[model samples]
Target chain A: MDSLAEELIQIKREGAAAVLATVTGADENGGVEPGQKCLVRDGKIRAGSIRDWALLQAILKEAEARLKEERSKLVPFDIPGTQGKAEVFFEVLPSPPKLIVVGAGHIAVPLVKMAKILDYHVTVLDDRLQFANRERFPDADEILVGDMAETLKGISITPWTYIVLITRGHKYDEPCLREIIHGPAKYIGMIGSRRRIKACFQRFRDEEKIAEEVIQRVHAPIGLDIRTETPEEIALSILAETIKVRRGGAAQSLSGKQ
Target chain B: MDTIYDQVKEFLDKGETVAVATIVSTKGSTPREVGAKMVVTAWGEILGTIGGGCGEADVRREAIEVIRTRKPRTVRVDLLDDISSDSPAVCGGIMNVFIDPWWKEKEG
Candidate 1:
């Protein structure tokens, strides 16, 4: 394979977010040609055929925005010195979203399984090895056994990460929430009853002085209003909520509301 | 990890010219979103799918031509004509797919 193709495969396998910008149309004498491409990863041009320095910089800036939104589109770029315009298609390859299930309980087993089915990089964590073993979470990418909140410190929390706080109790869930409440996780969900969740948020607001907006970001009493009963159903509901958040869906039923 | 690029890489490394067909833009009610891709080999074998039915078959025919000629072309697939038919590609939408030729010599 060519070096650029090989590099693209490596970037995808490593689950890195990158953008492939291809020039699809160019005005005559534009100094760019159709089918030319540049691969941008981590704000650097790792490979491709585009050569103009000015165009590369412009493409890099636009590529960053596309990667951030995780959307791909055909964009137009005007040449630096002329009326020539180059139409570039920016294709965003987002990394697999990480689903960290923080409590290897009954719900977690099904949650990990469902998340794996959805192609998430699933990680299961617990304070007890007996609960967080390979037997319970065979498909999980990482089975971590440690103090849940402390272990969270070791994991890199990016905007692609989703944290599901389903620990044994709110005593455990709250501390874990504190560890990541200010971090960059795209979704933070905690399992608890309405009353308990209210008390927990009150504590976070009054004692910890956590900002109200940050505290409100947590999806307490997590999952959609699906009236789920079984463990598998609950897992499905939680994942459905996560998917809604990820895809920006309307979260409405197809059957219509009567 | 299962990108059409992976399949394209495999074909190019074997010294074969492959046609990479991508759904660059889509209208309404299509089966798949834009950026959906499929790789067509010189022997007319497909690695992925850009929806199915007549739209794919039409693209496959054009993809074969793209492989033979080593030239990229855009195909406009209209599903509105088959809306009353039983074809699965009849989603009442139109999409423009760009079929590009990729080989070992082509960089980026």
Candidate 2:
């Protein structure tokens, strides 16, 4: 077998998501020993010390679920063909989340900055060259200048992608939202007022015939209800809401709950 | 960006063993989250950190032994005793660190 260290180095170099399952403990049956490992990537066993085909299949299934959730956990697995269990730790190594800011406006400035600090692979797209440039967004991983909605169609939207529509007007934002609403993006948030959002959703229902659950996936008025008063504060609230969604947090104050 | 694994690859290429210490689990208010890792050389050189301070020091000591013996072990790090101490790692929590020896033969 190839070196596990080499496999890990490759995973990091490729910026790909993978799971490292290690046997931490085993029952008296001695079916497995501690430190036995398997490297799972893209739903396949890339390499490792695990020799049991049945155990490898089980690890692959669990690794896929863990990668989707983007969490590392320790789980006990029943060793097939044996009367014992193996305690395995699934260490999830995920690539950085991609954030596509569909507008290079005021909120995009702070939003891109905050997302950079949070280690997101941020891309800022705008139709206006002046609004989307290196001068304004030095921290953004990618500064794209093109039609916002049309440009979104060219980008690959995966489950690890987050789309934030903060265009200058609904005419721009709505189209961008429509482009990604039914795509694979994990989070799609559009900036608008309550009345405007309601109208937009009505249009989706009446004109587009979009499902309610599909419309619900979008965070229309984008951000947590933190009574944000400034652009920076709004950016913070949006990122907070995004984190809440990513980590599955309640988004409620720990001290008091409603 | 010199990742921890990149450094581990360097040592493994030299046919040397290094100990990787990872916080597999934690209880209470630990300084770092689970899966935080640090690499330690056989000569006691350290790369990265697992919430430095007394808990880290203890893990470092055990890590060297793991490298020497080529064995893997788990150590429970307790920070409840030094709650009032000035150490920044005194997060009033406990964590279990799994130290595993990695060489050229083993996958990183």
Cα lDDT of model 2 by residue, A34-127, tens digit: 7889999888888888888888888899999999999888788898888889878889999778999988999899999999999999999999
Model 1 spans with C-alpha error above 4 angstroms: A252-258
Clashing pairs in 2: A4-B107, A4-B108, A5-B107, A5-B108
- Weakest ten-residue segment in model 1 chain A by summed lDDT: A249-258
lDDT of 1 by residue, A104-173 (tens): 9989999999999999999899999999999988899999999999999999999999999999998899
Per-residue lDDT tens digits for candidate 1, residues B1-108, read: 477777778888899998888888888888888888899888889888899888999999999999899877788999898678977678999998888888898867
Q: Which consecutive 10 residues in model 1 chain B have the weakest lDDT in total?
A: B1-10
Task: Please report, in order, the local distance difference test score of every candidate based on alpha carbons.
Answer: 0.87, 0.86
List pairs with backbone clashes in candidate 1.
none
RMSD of 2: 2.6
Docking class of 2: medium
Question: Deviation in angstroms for A182 in model 2?
Answer: 0.8
